[model samples]
Structures are given as structure tokens and as C-alpha cells.
Target: MNSKRSTEILVGLFVAAGIAALFVLAMKVSNLGDFTDDKGYEVVANFQNIGGLKPRSPVTMAGVRVGRVTGISLDPDTYDARVTINIYRQYDNIPVDTSASIFTAGLLGEQYISLSPGADDFYLEDGDVIDLTQPAVVLEQVIGQFLYSTAEGD
Candidate 1:
């Protein structure tokens, strides 16, 4: 009877540990593990191409993380990709002429939306569109251009 009780306790402890590990893993995956926080506001920017941009991807402004992408969709009239992002309320001083550009983290890393702020005194509203946008740079096109230029030079 003592052996049986010991085995039961071991199993229970193992199960509890697994549950705790799973919870930690989930929090990390969803980026909800952090304690200190600030509220943000949702805003949308349309793009001609939002190549491989995933939800929760960082939205950067002048090399700083201002927010993250909340959602993405398609426009019925323009067929462009509409990317929705949430900017922290404290960082909501973007000018009206600001533009968005799709950028990759590295040569083979993940992609993110980079916002380039303009000098306009007027700020963009919640639903305002970033008209001056640049799509993701095609790597293949860049390589081809490089090869073509080298051959011409030779």
C-alpha cells in the first residue's frame, strides 16, 4: 500500500509540472507573458503586397517598436491587402503624411511593417489611409538585377 501511494504522488507531480510548462509555453507564443503594459489603438494601412507578414509582427517607427499587427484583409474595390495594426496610445503622434513600408527582418527572417513618419503637423485619424506605401522588396528581383548589372559590367 505504501508503494502504491508513492507511485500515485509521483504521477500527480509529473502531471502538475507538465501543466505549468504548457501554460508558460502558451504565454510565450501569444506574447502575453509580460506584466508591464500600455493600451493601444487600432489603425489600418493598405498595401499592394504584404508578403509573409504574420499577425503579431512588430510595427516599427524609425527603428523602434511602436506596436504590432492585429489583422490583415483584402479590399473589394482595390484588391490591395489591408493591414490592421494597434499603436500604443502613448505613441499616437504620427503625422498625416506618414507612409508604411514592408520590410524583412533579414535575408531569410520574418517580415514586418515599418512606418516612416512624415513632417506634417496634422496627425492621422483612426481609419486614415497611408497612401505613400512601399511593398515588400522582392529578393529574386534584386538578385536578378545584380546578375544583370554584373554581366553588363563584364
Candidate 2:
């Protein structure tokens, strides 16, 4: 009876360990494990369209991630999408004239914001607005335009 009880206890422990491993995997896959509030300054950029860009999407600079999209809203007056990004404090030297463009990771991958720094010597400050912006390019629109042009040529 003693040996049987020890075996049962070991099985329970193994099951618990498996459950913990699964939980960690889920958090890592969904990007919820590294939650921290000190993400640094906030910057806003207005886009004509934001295709499938969600909150917590990465913000990259020259192909390197430097921040994440914190929020997205719409401007009722201008009818534009306002994207709020939180840049890391370590990358605070981004130029004021930097441009933000929405881009896809692959043909069907996730959408993210890409920042291109400008020649300006001044750096961006907290709550600054990025004036130069490019909206996301929808694949269907591009295909429609291509088909229209092809039919017109025929």
C-alpha cells in the first residue's frame, strides 16, 4: 500500500508539471508573458487606413523592433486612423521627422508599423505626433487595380 500511494503521488506531480508547461507556452505564444508598463514615451501617427493592425503589434525601426502599438483610434473630423505607439526609452533618439508606415511581415503575416528615421537632428519627445505617415496597402485593392489595368489594355 505504501508503494502504490507513492506512485500515485508521483503521477499527480507529473500532471501538474505538464499543466504548468502548457500555461507558459500559451503565454509565450500569445505575447502576454512579458507584460510591463514602463514602455516609454507615446507617439501618435495618423493613417488613412490601418489594415488588420491590432494593439500590441510590434513597431520596428529599420527592421529592428523598438516599440509596440499601444492603441488605435479614429479621428471623426478627418476620418483617419490614429495609431498610438509606445517606443522604448532606450530608443528615444528617433528623429522628429521620422515616418511611420504600416507593413506586413510576409504575404499573409501580421501587420506592424515601420519607422524610417529622417535627417533631422532633433529627437522625438513624448506625446509627439509623427506627421509623415503611409497607410497599409490592401492586397485586394492592388489585385483589383491590376485586373482593371489588364482589361483596359486588352
Candidate 3:
């Protein structure tokens, strides 16, 4: 009876460990594990359309992640979508003329902000707004345009 009880306890422990490992894996895969406060500088950019971009979306420069979107709001004055990004302090050398564009990881993957550096000598500072921005591309609009053109040509 004693040996049987010990075996049962070991099995329970093994199951519990497996469950914990799975939980950690889920959090990491979903980007929930890196929930620390943004220890970086904030910059704003306005877009005519944002599509499905949400907070916490990655901001990449040369295909390397440099920051994350911290907030997204609508500007009542200009009726534009205002996106706030928190850039890591280490990437402080981004030029003032750098351009930001919304892009997808894959054909139908999640959207993220991509930054292209410019030749300007000045660097962007905290709270500065990026004037050069490209809005997200909506796939539906492209398809609609294609269908309309094809029907017209027929």
C-alpha cells in the first residue's frame, strides 16, 4: 500500500509539471509573457486608416523588432487614427525622416509597423510625431478593385 501511494504522488506531480509547462508555452506563444511596462520612449504617428492594427503590435526596423505599439486612438480634429509606439531606448538613433508603414508578417498574418530609416542627420526624440507614415493596406479593397476592373473589361 505504501509503494502504491508513492507512485500515485509521483504521477500527480508529473501531471502538474506538464500542465505548468503548457501554460508557460501558451503565454510565450501569444506574447503575453512580456507584459512589463514600456521602458522606452513614445512616438506618435497618424494614419488615414489603421485596418486591424492593435496595441502591442511589433514595430520593426530592417525586419528586426525595435518597439511595440502602446496605444491607438482616433484624432477628432483630423479624423485620423493616431498610433502611439514605444521604441526601446537602445534604438534611439532612428532618423527624424524615417518612414513608418504598416505591413503583414505573411500573406494573411498579423499586421505590424515597419520603419525605414532615412538619410537625415537628426534623430527622432520622445513625444515627437512622425509625419511620414503609410496606413495599413486593406485586402478587401484591393480585391474589390480587381473584381470591378475585370467586370468592366469584360
TM-score for each model? 0.73, 0.79, 0.76
Worst 10 residues of 1 by lDDT: 30-39
Q: Write the per-residue lDDT of candidate 3 for residues 11-105, one digit (tens) a residue.
A: 99999999999988878676665555348799999998988899999999999999999999999999999999999888999999999999988
Question: Candidate 1, residues 84-127: lDDT per residue as tens digits?
Answer: 88887788789989899999997899999999999999987677
lDDT (CA) per prediction? 0.86, 0.93, 0.91
Which stretches of model 1 miss by more than 4 angstroms?
1-30, 33-39, 147-154
Which tens-of-lDDT digit does each residue in 1-154 have in candidate 2? 9999999999999999999889878786756554544558999999999999999999999999899999999999999999999998889899999999999999999999999999899999999999999999999999999999999999
With candidate 1 superimposed using the best TM-score fit, by how many Å does residue 17's alpha carbon deviate from the native? 9.1
Angstrom error of the Cα, residue 101, model 1: value is 0.7
Residue 36, model 3, lDDT: 56
RMSD after CA superposition, every candidate: 4.1, 3.7, 4.4
lDDT of candidate model 2 versus the reference: 0.93
Report the backbone clash tally of model 1.
0
